[model samples]
Target: MKDKTVAIVGGSSGIGLGVAKQVVAAGGRVFIGGRDAQRLERALAQLGPAADGHSVDSADDASVAAFFAAAPAIDHLFTPGASYALGRFMELDEATARSPMDHKFWGQYRVVRHALPKLDAQGSVVLMAGALGARVGLTGAAYAACNCAIEGLGRALARELAPRRFNTVSPGTIDSELWRERPAALREAAFESFAQGAPLGRVGTVEEVVDAVLFLMGNRFMTGSTLYVDGGYVT
Candidate 1:
């Protein structure tokens, strides 16, 4: 990662922020884009001189385009920015059910489309997928579809974009900032449920997922693949 520039969308918080910190620590520079101005500021402060960023909402094309416009040539790109509702298919309204694809899938599509001009020919792209895509359940039908779609996109793009690697990382429940805002009881219960299903008998950590991201970025031979960091939950 030395001297490489990694552009991470949705990088102000959660796993994206964790990736940025690691990239800096490994002698790489980062161009981080996120929706929250305050969080982006906080991340920049924590990252110090090694990082720079822009305010970007993945749901908006103009915002995403502008964000990438400010970045220099990018050696690697990661899109972990997405927000959507999760529920049983029958219980979800049209908009709510479609939100996952609308935001998570297309948001990444737009980021990658806009990034092509600056993305290095030899660089890699790591798209975010989730264990839900593989492990089916009563609810999360829409969320699972979105993740599966992303994995498909990663595979397709790897062929279309050649030389430039593209892969998806599917992580199970992780103890990360994404869960920090939830009520304590809800968080604990969810973790416990996920842990019981996994062979590891526990949820994963942000560092664990970030390790997968860095591996995808650095592995030249790994393209059009899906790396699962699900603690065997999808096994």
Candidate 2:
């Protein structure tokens, strides 16, 4: 990974931030983008000189365009940033039901579209998916569809883009900052439920998922594949 510059959207925190840290540790440079300016500042401080960042909202076309415009040529791109509401289809209003497709699915779509021109010819793109994409559950209909769309987009792009590889990483329940806002009791209960469902018998860690992302980024022969880092949960 030495000297490679990776551009990560939604990298201010959670899995995105974890990937940034690892990229820097491996002697690569990172250009991270996120909506939260303060959090982006903090992340850049933590990552030191090897990392830089821009304020970007993946949901906005102009913001995403400018974010990439300011960045130098990149060897790889990782988009782990997306925001959406999840609920049963009938319970959601039209806009609500479509939020995941708008934000999570189309958001990454915008990012990748803007990135291709600047991406290295041999560069790789890794999109984020989740266990829900493969294993459906109640109240996650829109979310699951969004993930499936992303995986399909990745595969299609792999074929269309040729040498510029594309892949998706679908992770199961991970004990990451995404859950930090939840009440302790609620968080623990959800974790317990997820643990019982997965063969690993516990939630995953950010490092574990990040490892898979790094592998996908480094493996030139891997493209059009959806790698599950879900601890057998998808099986």
Candidate 3:
């Protein structure tokens, strides 16, 4: 992976940052994009000197296009962040629910569409969805719908990209900042609930999801596959 260029959209935090760190550890040069400059800088700092930072708004086509234009020939591309808004079906507002479709679903779509031309022949694209794509539980309709769409997109792109390799990583209940945003009591309760429900008896870690991404990026033979890092959540 030494000297290989990897471009990651939404790499400022969470799973994206995890993957960026792993890529750098594997001897790859990384360019990470996010809307927050400070967060991006901090991520780059943690990733060491081999990582570069860029400001990108995944919802904006112009921003995505320009970021990709400045990126070097990418050996691998990964998008681990996506917009999320949760609410019951009846409580879900049309605009709010569809917002994730624009950011998470279409955002990933745009990244691949624009980055494809810049990818090396053997390059791979690893997209992040979640267990909601295949499993049904407490998540709202928007999350489930968008994730399912992401999975379908990966399959189609895998066939279209052919030898280039396109795949999706579906994680379940990862302990990311998203969960940290909640109140301590609520967070603890949520974690405990997940621990009891998940077949693995624990939530996933950022490194676990990162390992799956690395596996997909390094393996040339795997494509059009939805690799579940969910720890039996779907079972």
Candidate 4:
């Protein structure tokens, strides 16, 4: 990772931030971007001198465009940004079901379009989708639809992008701040229940997923592949 420049959009926290830390630790420079300036600041603070931050709204073209325009030459791009509408399929509204495409798929499109010209010749791109997309899950129709599309998009880009690699990481329930939205007890119980179904018998970690992201970026031979870092949940 030495001397490599990695850009992580929506990287202020969670798996994205995990990757940033490792990159910097390995003597690479990381530019962390996100919608919240304060969060990016906090993230950069934790990352120390090898890190920088930019405010970016991945869903908006102008914000994404301007954000990338200012980036130093980047060798890898990772965006773990996603929004979901959760409910029964029949009960979901049109906007809720379709929002993932606009925000996740097209959001990635906007970032890639802006970053392509500036990326290193051997650069890599890692996009995130949920484990729900790779398998069936109740009350996640909208989320599943969006990630399923992302899986396809990553494969398509692998071919279109040529020597540059593009991959998707579909993570199962990871132990991250994302669970903070739920009451602590409920979140723990939910994870405990979900973990039992996986062969690993545990939820994943940001460190584990981050390792996969780094692997995808570092391996030039890997392209257009969907790596499930889901603790065997997909199995």
Winning model by TM-score: 1
Clash statistics: count for each candidate: 0, 0, 0, 0
Stretches off by above 4 angstroms in model 4 are none
Taking all chains together, the TM-score of candidate 1 against the true structure is 0.98
Per-residue accuracy of model 2 over 45-104 as CA lDDT, tens digit each: 999999988999999999999999999899999999988887887898989889989998
What value does the lDDT take at residue 222 in candidate 2? Answer: 99
Rank by lDDT (best first): 1, 2, 4, 3
Cα lDDT tens digits, model 4, 69-118, are: 88999999998865555778888788887777788878988888998988
> What TM-score do all the candidates reach, one by one?
0.98, 0.97, 0.95, 0.95
RMSD of each: 0.9, 1.1, 1.4, 1.4
**Model with the higher TM-score, candidate 1 or 2:** 1
Write model 3 residue lDDT over 9-55, tens digit each, in one string. 98989988888888888788998999988988889889998888778
Candidates 3 and 4 compared: the better one by lDDT is 4
**lDDT pick, better of 2 and 3:** 2
Relative to the true structure, candidate 3 reaches a TM of 0.95
